[model samples]
Target: MTLRNQVLIWIAFFIVLMLALWIFRGILLPFVVGATLAYLLNPLVNQLQKWRFSRGWATAVVLLSVVAIILGLFFMLVPLAGQQVGGLIQRLPGYASDLQELARRWAPELNAWLGPEQAARLEATISDLLGRIVGFAGGITGEILASGWGVITTIGIVVFTPVVAFYILLDWEGMVRGVNNLLPVQYKDEIRGILAEIDSSMAGVIRGQGSVILILAVFYATALSLAGLNFGLAIGLIGGLFSFVPYVGFAIGFLLSMGVAIVQFWPNWWMVAVIFAIYMVGQFLEGNILYPKLVGSSININPVWLMFALLAFSLLFGFVGLLLAVPLAAIGGVLVRYGVRKYKASALYLGENGDKGGDQTAV
Candidate 1:
């Protein structure tokens, strides 16, 4: 085939593959997740096998250990989260009252600025806004609890994930070899090089980001708990997990925690200041220590590009898109780098030094 024909064929193949991935994405998530788990656990399984353990035994042990860790975290976090949520729910009414009173005290100053009639209208508008906010919050909570089929579906996914992961881990090497064998022989070396680069990039990003997030969670949770803030653990967990998306975690945790501290300990600026200080310290530590250590040499996606990728993917494919955005971005970066390298070597960009003639004629 001509070079142009080969290029066209390859483009068509990729287009079809992307379309298939988009159409069957829902069914693919579990498999994608399982494959990632297998990849991450492969090293540990190899080490176990090196210790003279049978492959089957090593796979079982590694899978079970992973499952046990997940189960333990669930058991530990659920009750704490439940208690915190329950307490927050119970205090909702009092928080509303306090907020209303605070607003009312500020209304007279509004009256002096806008006159009594306009001020009363402004106050009513504010009250209505507050009511709608509370109603929206209540609606979300109710939907989560009352949507029976949704709850069941979620539970099923949770239960089956580990089972899928276990089998994938057990057969990971065979799977890799099978895939490699299927690649076209002429392109096998290039494909292998790209795959290795992708693997290294993904491992660095996923494992490093995960470790950093865990450390930040512990730091934030401990600091908030020591400061005696209600819902501290929840805030910290949310912050740390979302920290993978740049400043999102810190912004969310800081704002939410500050708002809660203000309402719960009103007129006590000291508590509010302390809460802010704790979040600042957490941010400092993450920037100076955790991120540097964990995410070293990983894809350096700028904040603007990162946010754009998140927004675009989330809009296109919802949660799965959001989860895959960073990896996709990393892959795009790799492709771009390769393209740049090729361009630099190409005749169009090389001027008089172009590979147009034989080596001896290239002055």
Candidate 2:
């Protein structure tokens, strides 16, 4: 077969593979999570093997340790999270009253510019907004309770994921070698190079970004707690975790924290000021220290492109799209860089003298 025909066939195969992944995403989630966990832990398992331990033993040790840590965390966090969630629910009515009072006190002055009817209309609008917010909160609470089955299924998946990861880690090297051996000899070196590049890029981005998110979470939680905010721990934890998607953590944390502060201390500008100050300090630390130290220069996706990709993916595939967006963007960035380099080197783009825009070369 001609090189052109081979290229077409390879492209067609990849398109089909991507379609399959998209269609079977629900079934694939556990395997994908397991594979990612294996990738992250493989280095540690390899190090244990170097200490004269057999590969199987090392894999078993790592998997068991990981499982123990996860279970310990679940035990410690679940009760605390449940308590905080319940407390928030209990406080909702008080919060609603505080919000209503603040609005009633402030609305008349702003309404003075307009007639009483306009003011009443403005108050109605505000009431409608508050009602929607309450409805959303109630909806979320109902969903959580309704999702008892989902919670059980999720726990099962989490338990099974690490177990699957252990076997995958153990066989990772052999799997790579087997796939390489199956490739045509003529293209083996090129394929190996591509795979190695992709693997390195994925590993660096995943590990680095994950560490950054954890660090930011700690920073946010500590700062908020120190500022003596209600539900600080919960807000900080959620904010920090969601920070993986660029500024999402900051946006969510800011709005939630500000709302809580306003509700807790009605008409007290000072409390809102304190919350804002805490968030500002946390943001400064994240921008100056945490992200720099953790992610470094690993992911080169620009903010604009990252947001666009995230929105597009989320629209197309919901939560799964959101989860996969950054990794896909990182991979696309790498491929785009390679394409640019190749384009610059090509005779079609570069002149015979290798000077861009000089005399064009005939193909």
- Per-residue CA lDDT of model 1 for 1-363, tens digit only, reads 665796698789868866776786555556666666776788899999999988889989998898789789889887897687567655656666667788688788988999999988987875675566456546645754553326555665576667787888777778999999998899799889878877767876677777888888888877887888888877677678778888878876776577678787778989999999998888888888877777776676677887888888756655556667787777766766766776677766565557545454554
lDDT (Cα, 0-100) at 245 in candidate 1:
84
Clash count for each candidate, listed in order shown: 0, 0
RMSD to true structure for each model, in Å? 5.5, 4.4
Pairs of colliding residues, candidate 2: none
Full-model lDDT for every candidate? 0.75, 0.76
By TM-score, who's the top model here? 2
Lowest lDDT 10-residue stretch of candidate 1? 140-149
Q: Candidate 2 overall Cα lDDT vs. reference?
A: 0.76
Candidate 1 Cα errors over 4 Å, as ranges: 1-10, 82-149, 184-187, 351-363
Tens digits of per-residue lDDT for model 2 on 1-363? 774697699689868866876786555556767877897788889899899989899999988898899789789976786677678667756766677777788776867877788888887886676666567657656754553427665875787788779889889889978998899898788767766666666765688788778777777777777877888777788789878777878886776688788877666789789899888988888789877876767677788888888888666654556667787888778777766876778776776567865754432
What's the lDDT for residue 250 in model 1?
A: 83
